[model samples]
Target: MVGGGALVRKPASPVGPLALLHRPVPEPPSSLRRGPLREGAWRSPLRSERTATLLGMWVGVAFAVCFATGLLSHLIQNPPSWFGWPSRPVNLYRVTQGLHVISGFAAIPLLLAKLWTVYPKLFEWPPVRSLLHAIGRLSLLVLVGSAIFQLVTGVLNVARWYVVMPFFFTTAHYWTAWIAIGAILVHVGSKLAIIRIGLSEPAAAEPPAAAVAGGLTRRSFLTAVAATSGVVALTTAGQTVPALSGITVFGQRDPRLGLQGLPVNKSAASAGVLETAVDPTHRITLDGPRPQQLSLAVLRSLPQHTVRLPITCVEGWSATADWTGIRMADLLDMMGLPEDAEVTVESLQESGLYRASVLAPPHSRDPLTLLALRLNGADLHIDHGYPARLIAPNRPGVLQTKWVSRVRAL
Candidate 1:
């Protein structure tokens, strides 16, 4: 009688709803019968090798992103704003400049790993020795050399460091980077055949012939990837997380940090004539024949001004430092130089781009700008123009002259 009653009531114990809720949803029947998934459903297994090659080219692609953003940054930073560059009516250089530096910095380990993986292939002999070999060798050399130079300079720039070399890395860095692009183009363009051969038939693609010959395998490659990523993560955490900075197991030469510093001139006198004297006797001659040395102490004693200015470089990089020094306008006032007269900042370093002197316009008199003597709440490093340097808001680092001994107001 109970069973008959349950059937009559359609089993209304909520069991059916609960069963419906708990049951797994079935996958929709694929249109692909036994052959393959629909066009988008399943990519051919052959594409795996192609995928690897493309992944391997990621470093080169990163370099391209850096160069484009960096060059774009330079034009925007310019006073006149040439080449249809974005006008900084709202200071857009901040975004692009950051992209440039971040992109440049991130490329460090990517490039290293990519190079390590592909370098072995360079020794592979051509089936037929000819121009391809010569071209490939030359392209590899240019790519590797350019990449090293670019990344080294890039990482140091992020650290707010400089050497007694080129101040206008924007012009020189951009110029060389463009050359790098050309080299990369040749590298890619020349290797299209080989890349195509490997990638065209991903299904047919097996272990890279060279890698197999060298006893490398996908498993080994994966292990290397895991190791590289771990190191990078540790490196990143140490930098961003102050807590981890204490447990720096790695030495000072952080792989992620790249080279520790820029080239500095030890012979260049670190002691400036300005630092040696006191306030009363010190006189700053500006817009005059020469800078009348004034007591920077006196300038400090008057009113302490602080502008946290970030020096952005055209090479797609930037660094922030607390700028503390006499205002360019005040210096002009002290020197009795005309407000309109242009003051040229000459670095101890030679020009890497042009033959003639690079000049910062008279607009440097802006109150926000100052001759910086300190960085990050401390004394400037010798590697970073020890005694004095120029700090301007949003100007490329090259324009921020280092090892600045002479500020002639002409």
Candidate 2:
């Protein structure tokens, strides 16, 4: 008997051979026969394989998008020898990182629905039917655990609530993403047949378990879940999509609210560089074959060029502004560095994970890359990296390296 004392008919086995050798099946342990394991503990007709399968498909797709975009982001920040990120299509990082965050948010509802639909399975009796079944269940645990971790950490990171997280957000999130995606693939491969059956048209005589009179029909439930996902995406996407800013109740940053018509993730005060940035003795040292120290006055006097660029943050907000500064190529030329030289840009901020960033040859030589001195036709705001800051196309906001101190060829 299964749930609700319903008699479960068993298929007859061949009895002509080896009948006497077949041993009687053992009874399940007391631990497996109580609470949720009780015969009628879960009676919800809505918890069907079909509904679970549908929700699972959508969750998988959302995770796929997040994985792709997130991996791209990690690689760009920590590029390998063969990986070369493009410098063109200035808004490329903006769009991709935005989609990464939006998709992660959208997955929350779908993931919850999927878990609700299949939650009863977590209490299945005879949990380890075989070695293969044990392996499958283990994968499910990894899938659910890592998926939850990714979403929770992602949301916290966006909210800038790092105190609650015990581990380093970026490193933990990046590595666990691999585990989540791998488990998802294993789960999908194991459930291929069931997925196909669930997605297909129902048979004429199929039971109407999900058609409970007072509760939500399966179609209605699915529609509600999808609508919730859509709502989440729309509300939070204003961080990246300027058109929806008015309705963005949960966005981390307002594109229109910040220093010089742009959002500031890290201010000069927060970075502990306020006094250092304003000090008259400050000079950006360029260390290469021909070392030179250029003060703020010298940086401004050296032929200034203005180019429009967007600063895209990993948290998903982006803002574009006209940056006036000396081109990176020009700076490199002044240092007597070759065209393909790699450089490390340092900040005046005393300490932080991103106080310094290495600029690869492509970005170092790119004409659009600048050691910015002004924003929106005025001198750089103290919070927006006064004196000088690096502004490069298709680069993350963190890598912009505020409060110019030194640039060294690597």
Candidate 3:
């Protein structure tokens, strides 16, 4: 009142329901505000929100591609009633499985870069600001944990190194993918506004710092990260892309280095069917309307047809070979079974998850589906399912069922 202003009022205090949200954050004690929690701990210009956001976008895309392809592989291996896969295109599974593995490898470098760019946030003062903040941080733990687990397990699987994992890789990897994807969705939704701003705003160059020397700029850091990812993908993709096979440093199997000039995921000896596969008394049983147990000689005596088919493995390596065998459809016709009948192929393996595989009508009746007895020309290599094996178009190598012992109509 003493000044020129008349009837001046102080700002009204926040009085609504969400007033607590408007209150100032409490300051921490001196003892609690040391080390990374100190005000000047983070000063790197390269750790800007823009850099993190850009890397996160690439990480998100890679994870999405990896998850979609992985889910398709799982469904194909264990299809429900609603699912039905086609028998044409021959290389469908190969392409999908290869993409699944390659995208996963690409994500490794992108994720690491994103995490490094955002590392300063991990040490933010007064870590738990609200209930939502605590939940969000917890979700990040799950996200990072699951993402790391997936990449590690996937690399191990690709290398065929199963001894280190306590649980089955397929089952654990499949379930954890769901958790990782959910956490990523929640994180993305919560940061949508910040993400928009980070992407829209220009990345300004940081002023020169006397303390830090030779640190990477934001653009250069991003470029390096992208180049690393590209190198990883190009080197690993050779497992599926034949043209790049010569430079495949990380591929588990060579497309041209196994029995019969085709890669083999599991050999007859490893399957414990080595003796049984070549036993003179071995008989391939076909159970149907006209059940018959035919010996290897009789199987050879029956009508023979040759087809060039690729043995595509889930491990992302494939090789084409000339397979000679009895047509599955022709065998069904001779056994008085319907053309569309489904069947279960049982292998001579004493015990294994892939010892048996179920074939739906599409594959069972496909013209290229064969009870193969020979590969390339001569009798099948012992490791290539000597007596007889199931060879079908557009099917995973695991489901090709080596050392066939029986085919039962379902």
Per-model TM-score versus the true fold: 0.52, 0.90, 0.91
Q: What's the best-to-worst order under lDDT?
A: 2, 3, 1
How high a TM-score does candidate 3 get? Answer: 0.91
| Candidate that scores best on lDDT | 2
Candidate 2 lDDT by residue in tens digits, 34-67:
8887866897766666788889999999999999
Where does candidate 1 stray beyond 4 Å?
1-52, 65-109, 112-138, 145-179, 193-280, 288-304, 311-326, 330-341, 346-365, 371-389, 396-406
The local distance difference test score of each candidate is 0.53, 0.88, 0.86
Model 2, stretches more than 4 Å misplaced? 1-25, 29-35, 203-210
Q: Per-residue CA lDDT of candidate 1, range 1-410, in tens?
A: 42464433455433465554434444444432233223333422222435445544766777887888776665644435334432122234545655565556656766776665564355343312444345556667787887777877666554446673366544556677877777878777876876785467544345666636765455455446546645644553333233444543321222123112222222234334233222244343333643465444654564445776655444333334466765776666665666666666655444333111223443456677676666666656655554556666555555667655456765
Q: Score candidate 1 by TM-score against the native.
A: 0.52
- What lDDT is reached at residue 325 by model 3? 98
* lDDT: the better of candidates 1 and 3: 3
Error of 3 at 72 (Å): 0.4
Models ranked on TM-score: 3, 2, 1
- The root-mean-square deviation over C-alpha atoms between each candidate and the true structure, in angstroms, is 18.0, 4.5, 5.1
C-alpha lDDT (0 to 100) for residue 266 of candidate 3: 85
lDDT of 1: 0.53
